[model samples]
Target: MKVNIRKWNGVAIWSWDVPKEEVCGICRASFDTTCSSCKFPGDQCPLVLGVCTHRFHTHCIEKWLEVETSKNLCPMCRQWFQEKTDDGDGGTGAHANTNVHSSDVVSTT
Candidate 1:
């Protein structure tokens, strides 16, 4: 049997490697979804994993850190929030602005 095709379409789907039941510590939204401040998911609302091992939506954590009372602490563990770096050095500091993205994250899955 022989087959010939002239037209073709392809669809692809992608998702964060986080567990389905896990939610952002700050926004309480799943890692696969955007935070309340974001209109859509993906880079616009990337997930940030803190040195304390708590995860939050980028916008959520950014907003929280901006508040004077937040004291740059992880909303979940109350530890100083720092963007876990690639070197596994814990991170620089809460205000370091690591600019990390989900795609750049080392998969913990």
Candidate 2:
């Protein structure tokens, strides 16, 4: 009696629903990490996506919005950066333009 053996090959792919491939526009730092002002990245400085689909670090975007020049506009699209409402869960939820009056807004993650 004789037996034969076969080898199997497989591939796995991973992805995230982020708006960009890398880095926050405002701070120019990788999405996987936090901005300069933050002592740590990750959960402490998670990424935030604007209604315009522009991406930035959470801390970075907050600082940018606080500036008088920003006027609550997305740096990339110049669209009114609608604020996101917390889902009550740990993650962020849909976009709510409670301040502005634009119909082109999209939900953020």
In model 2, which runs have C-alpha deviations exceeding 4 angstroms? 1-20, 84-95, 98-109
Give the clashing residue pairs of candidate 2, or none: none
Per residue, candidate 2 scores C-alpha lDDT tens digits across 18-99 of 6446778888877765688777656666777665667788888899999999998898888888655565644344435444
Model 1 lDDT tens row, 1-109: 9999999999978888788999997778888888889888887888888877777888899999999999988888888888775564445445455577888989778
Index of the highest-TM-score prediction = 1
lDDT of 2: 0.72
TM-score of each: 0.75, 0.59
Give the RMSD in angstroms, all C-alphas superposed, for model 1. Answer: 10.4
